[model samples]
Target chain A: MAEKIKILYVDDEPGNLIGFKASFRVDYHVLTAVNIPQAINYLDNNPDIKIIFCDQRMPGKTGVDFFEEIRISHPLPVRILLTAYTDVESIIEAINRGNIFRYVKKPWAEADILSSIDEANKFYTANSMLMVKNEELQKAYAELTKFAYSVSHDIRGPLSGMLGAINLAGEIDDIEEIKEMLFLMGKSLTKLDTYILSMHDYYSLQRGELKITNIDFNKIIDDLKAMYMVISKSNKIVFTTTVDQGEVFRSDEVPLRLILNNLLSNAFKYQDKKSTNKSVEVSIEVHKNQAIIYVKDTGIGILGNHIGEIFDLFYRANFQEAGSGFGLYNVKSAILKLGGNIEVNSVLHKGTTFKIIIPSI
Target chain B: MDKEFSFIIIDDSELDCFVIQKVIERAFKNLDIISFQNANNALEAIKEQGVKTKPTIILLDIQMPLMNGFQFIEEFEKFSPQIQDCYTVIILSILSATRAPADIHTEFNKRIVGSIIEKPFTIEKLLSLLKNMGLADEKIVLSGKKLLP
Candidate 1:
């Protein structure tokens, strides 16, 4: 059943307040106030009140005056001023100033007031939705500006480095020296390409719709291990995984892979060179429709102060290497889109561990 | 005799470090240039070297993965004045239009940053800047190529 729409009827006359409550009590959560102070009290207490009706002739405050005053604090509720036929000029001025949604006649008919309440409720809902969407649009716009700046700076920085190497390569004739320059140029190109690809993933993750399906944990784990095989060997870090899933787990696969790949690569990237024993351990368990995953790494761990902001966009916890700075941020966005939560634990020079719990869709 | 100085290249970009290293190597002989991709690692090195380190010149990048140029300077400020005053920190970045070096120097003081140089820098600009700061006394020669007319 739909929740009852709350309505507050304010009138100086006690008889009118009683009549208003008696008429609409069945359909709405009807609240009655004898004066402006009582009406203001009701509004303050019941924030969810959708429609407000006030009598034009009150002790010290007119209905229009009360409506205008409440516009700032109680703006969400639709305001309706009740006035006599002789008060046409005031009603016109109040409506012109956009203080009230509509004005009801002094001797309001029960049927007429009921229809007005229904219309006012719909208007209130639409207004609230617009406000929410506007806020979202503003936030997205801000992020877009940041994205533009990041793309240009990150992409051009590498390109310029490659350009300089190429210029120098043309002037040098020695094969060995040219070979070294070519190697550096190749690395610059690779970095630039990777940044572009990550930018693509960031956008798609934000705008793409979730395609929920049965997720094969074994296959995903195999792919992850294969992907990081070279890096693990190069860095001399042992990689291990333990998966325990009895029944088939279901979730979106693309984002799942995105999250795992980023975390694993970071494990390899930030390892301490001096540490003799470097390793990454992955554990996944699925039971009772929830998949719990843990990726722990014996790497140069994040600082205590940076732990909270590590997942924010373009926030790098360690300056170990030049990266897209979107890896953890994208992981966080993908996890959130799947209605999951992730937590990080770390100590300086020790290691970092990430725990994630995602309920199956 | 010219005062000998070492350098710390605190940039996340390996390519930027490579280019800068080449420039330095080509222009001068027998100079110590230490490069770190991460600021924290550089901080560790600075702490170890302490006052024994030479009058070091730091080429710092503004936009880095962890601990940007400004954040690194904030950490650098925690060192003793003896250690702090021995180094010249210069902001080298592609983000010149967005961030002003003078503004940062005013905010952090000249003790933190000597100046800013926009990226895609040439050896000529770098050597001249060093000379102006009185860090380079020997005439810089760029691989049989004259950087100054």
Candidate 2:
């Protein structure tokens, strides 16, 4: 069942307050105050009060004055005025200055009060939703500006480098030096290709819906091994995998592949070049409808301060190697879409490990 | 043409550094060139060399990881006048001209910065810049190969 809507009623007469509470307490969480100070206290304490009713001709202040003051302080609540005397000037003032939604007579009908409450609640709901969407639109606008700046920098940075290299190639006469320039140009193209692929993955992950199916850990691990075989062999890094899955495991294959590919690529990319005993280990265990996987590598591990910010968009820990800084952010987003959690453990110059656990949907 | 001056290239991209070094080398005979991949490391080297370092023209890239070109100028401003006066900086970046000039006017130290050069720097641009600075008028060598004598 839906929760009851809360409403506030303020009056100078205690009898009127009690009667108002008794009438509406069954359908609403009704709060009543006898004086202006007490009414302000109720508003301060109860932020979720959606509808407000104030009676005119109070002791110290009029209901119109109270509504006018709260129009700035508590603008989200719908305000209504209740008065015994039918003064046309004050009623017009209440509508124009006090911003009251409706004015009811002293001898109000039960049906009229109920209908006013219903309309006021509907206005409150629509206003709250508008505020939420306005905030979201502002946030997306800021993100889009930052995204545009980063995209230009990432793409142009490499192309400019290539142009510089090509100009140098024309003036040089030594074949070996020219060959070296060609090698560097090849590296730049590779960086460009990697960045484009990451952009594609980012777009699809944002727009595509998840497709869940029964996942076979062994088959996925074998495929990964085959994909990375040549690079692992050339780099002299031993890659090993072990999977202990005795029960069924289900997940979205695309995101799962994205997560593993990113993690495994980083494991191979950040290895200490001088380290002779380079290795990567992958271990997975599935039980109790959860899959726990670990990807460990012997690499130049991340510094302690950078671990917290590694998942942020366009954050790079080091400039020693070329990267678009989208790899780990995509990994984290994919893991979140699969309802999974990941933890990182690392020691500088030693190694780093990522442990992830995902539950079957 | 015996007056000696060194060139310092500060850019994070190794390939850009290599290209700039080659371009500078081809234009001048036996000119000293130093390149650092990190801005902080370059600052450390400058401080270590102190006032004894040779008169230098620094080619600085704007977008770096830890310290940017403007931040490097901010640090450079704290040096003694004797050391500071020995170097002049020129920005080398891929930033658009409309934005780069405005940033240089507002954020950079006017006295220390000589000018701004867009990326993919060529030898002709470098020689033209040196001529404008009065450093190419018989004081600096022009390698005599496809260069204005």
Candidate 3:
């Protein structure tokens, strides 16, 4: 059954209250009170009453006066003052005094009274909804402020550190120190890149649209190996890759790129730089409708305990060491968003391997 | 006499330590550069190196997983005085000043630190860092390349 709207009619004369009830009782859950005190008592008992209809003239207290007394304690019951044609001035006074919804003329048509009640119900519901939405919006605004503060203080903080280091390096007049300055500048630049990527991840997760499309695993791995040649060359680590062609998944390739780029880059990062035989190898295998890509590197592997929580936000194996810690977090969020998963196999001092699996289409 | 020494930069971030090692190696051609990603292992090796006076500097990164730079220093204190004397503490970090209060710059300037350098530390600042630490009489090395104009 539809929720019935309760309405209360108040008049000094018992006949008027009885007549009002006879008119609205079937269509509404109607309550009649022959005096102001009785009306207040009815309102206390029937909390669901949404609209109140009261005669402007009463034996001792007027409708506006009664409403004024209860305004602070029992607010939100929509009020409509009832006045006779001759009491037009009192009706106008009550409207201003009680902030009434609207007034009905005494000896009103049955149809007019019912129509007024219907309109009052609509007004009450609409106002209630707007109030709820407003509260929600206010809550959202508070949360947004906290997010903004964290982004500004933490996200930009490291970038500013880079900027300071760069400026300090530039101040040196030594002819021989230029090379060291540029090298230092490069490190600072990468930290800046990490910060920029962090901002990108946030906006993308919030409002940016990721293009979902089929991506070739073989091609992505090949490209990744080629791109990482610089790190391999510098570290003197052998870059090797093996890929077994597999069916592509329909997912956003942008997130895939970020995930792969970060993982591969991290793999190279921990390699034995002074050892010429050090290497990073990437291979993919397809099985049971799942496409698995493995990035294995003969580098300083992750700690046994750290693997489980590497994907947590703001957690870095090395805090403020170099990476923003946003990389793996973004990858995890991206995978969850795409309905995919990732797993890690690592042993300290031996190496670390990340196995990323996706539904093959 | 131009002396050459190998420096072990122990920092959690391979990138920052790599930059430091590269810059130092370039400036001083004969400065052997070694890198370690963990503190406890590095401390163990540092202790085992035997202190009878060989020229060695350990560029320490402050924040790491198992042990921070200070914690490493605290443990290093347990070593023989002569061995501890061989290594100098140069604090490396992303500076981590964001979580700190507004007066961090004032606090960071306290002379307790031999030198406080930021990450992605460029060659020039590092050489100045070397100069500031009295290690400037050399060339900077980055990724096996000697950075000397």
Candidate 4:
């Protein structure tokens, strides 16, 4: 059952407060205060109170004045003013200045009061939803600004380097020097290509919906092996994989593939150049609707301080190798979309291992 | 022309460093050119070399990981007056002059920063800038080429 909505009623007369509570206590969690000061205390203590009812004939302060004072501080609660028919001017003031939602007659029937509570509760719910959406919109706007700045910096940084190289290529006459410039230009082009590809992945993950299907670990392992075969063979790094799947597993294939592809590529990219025994190991186990996978590498591991930030967008831990810095961020996003989690362990100059646990949809 | 100055190129991009070095080498012969891929290393080198290094021009890139160009300047400002006077810093960036961060225009940075040069730096721009600074003669010769008429 849903929790009862809280209601607060303020009146200078103690008997009237008890009567109001008795009438609505069954339907709402009723809170009563005999004066404006006591009512303010209740409001400060019970922030979740959704409706406030106050009588206009209170001594020293009227109901409309109390609502007006709290209009800025406790804006979330719906304020309803109770007044005698002779006090028509107070009703108008309540509507204009106090921002009251409705006005109840001083001698109210149970039916009219119940209907007002229902309507005011609906308004409160909608207002709360709007506030939440406003916060989300503001956060997204900030992310968009940062995204624009980073996109411009990453794309132009390389193009300008290539242009500079071309300018120098024209001026220099030495063949060896020109060859070196061409090599650097080639490297810049490669970096640009990698950046564009990862950008495409980032957008797809953002806008695409998950397409869940039965996942085949064997096929995924085969594709990964085939993809890295040439490079792994040439670099003399051993690539190994073991898969144990005793039952059917279900997940979104696209994101799962993205996660493994990024992790494997990093494992290969960050290998110690002089280490003759470079290796990457992958092991997968599926049982009882869960998949646990590990990808371990004998590479120059990340520094301990940088591990916390490696998953952030456009964050790079090491500058020795050319990276788009989108790889791990995209991997984390895809994993989140699949309702899974990832963990990493590494030691500098030794090795690094990534463990991922994904539940079947 | 008689006073030779060393060049310190601090940029994370190797290709940009290579291009800038070649452009400077083509325009002038046998001037000392030092390049660092990281800004922290560059700052350490400046501290270690002290005043023994030649009078230098530091071409700085704005956006880099760990330490950016502005942060580099903040550290550079802490050097002694003699060491600070030996170097002239210029912002070398892909951002246009108008889009550069407002911090670049602060009075503190203004004292140390010589000028802002957009990316794809050219020999023509470098030569004109040096002439305006009175560091180069009005007519300068390219290496192994005739003097500009």
Candidate 1 versus truth, CA RMSD in Å, comes to 4.1
lDDT of 3 by residue, A133-156 (tens): 999889668757655644553444
Cα-based lDDT at residue A43, candidate 3: 85
Candidate 1 segments exceeding 4 Å error: A1-4, A12-18, A25-47, A56-69, A84-98, A111-115, A171-178, A229-238, B1-8, B38-57, B74-89, B98-115, B127-149
Structural similarity to truth (TM-score) of each candidate = 0.83, 0.85, 0.47, 0.83
* lDDT agreement of model 4 with the native: 0.88
Displacement of residue B56 (Cα, Å) in model 4 is 0.9
lDDT of 4 by residue, A268-346 (tens): 9999999999999999999889999999999999989999999998888886537887999999999999998999999
What is the fnat of model 1 with respect to the true interface contacts? Answer: 0.54
TM-score of 1: 0.83
- In model 3, which regions exceed 4 Å deviation? A1-172, A206-210, A233-236, A246-248, A318-321, B1-66, B69-149
lDDT of 4 by residue, B22-86 (tens): 88876677888999989999999999989855679999998888778888998999999889988
Candidate 1's residue-wise lDDT over B1-149, tens digit each? 23278778987777778777766655555778989888889999999988964698899887887577878988999999999988898888775645533454455567668777777766776776787787765454333135222
Q: After superposition, how far is residue A218 of candidate 1 from its true place, in Å?
A: 3.0
Candidate 2 ranges beyond 4 A from true positions: A1-49, A54-75, A85-100, A238-250, A285-293, A357-359, B1-3, B138-145
Pairs in clash, predicted candidate 2: none
Evaluation by DockQ, superior candidate among 2 and 4: 4
Error of 1 at A57 (Å): 4.6
Complex DockQ, candidate 2: 0.57
Tens-digit lDDT track of model 3 for B1-149: 24545678886654455446655655566756778878888877887777845567677766465576777877877787677677666666554445433443453424334666665455565567666676545443232234444
User: Regarding TM-score, does 2 or 3 come out ahead?
Assistant: 2
DockQ-based ranking, best first?
A: 4, 2, 1, 3
lDDT (10s digit) by residue, model 2, range A1-361: 6788889999989999899999999999999999988988999999999999999889888999999988899999999899888878998989988999989888777888899999999999999999999998997788677677677767888899998898778778899989888887888788888888998998888779999999999999999999889889999999999999998899999999999989999999899999999999999999899999999999999989999999977777876647787899999989999999999999888889999999988
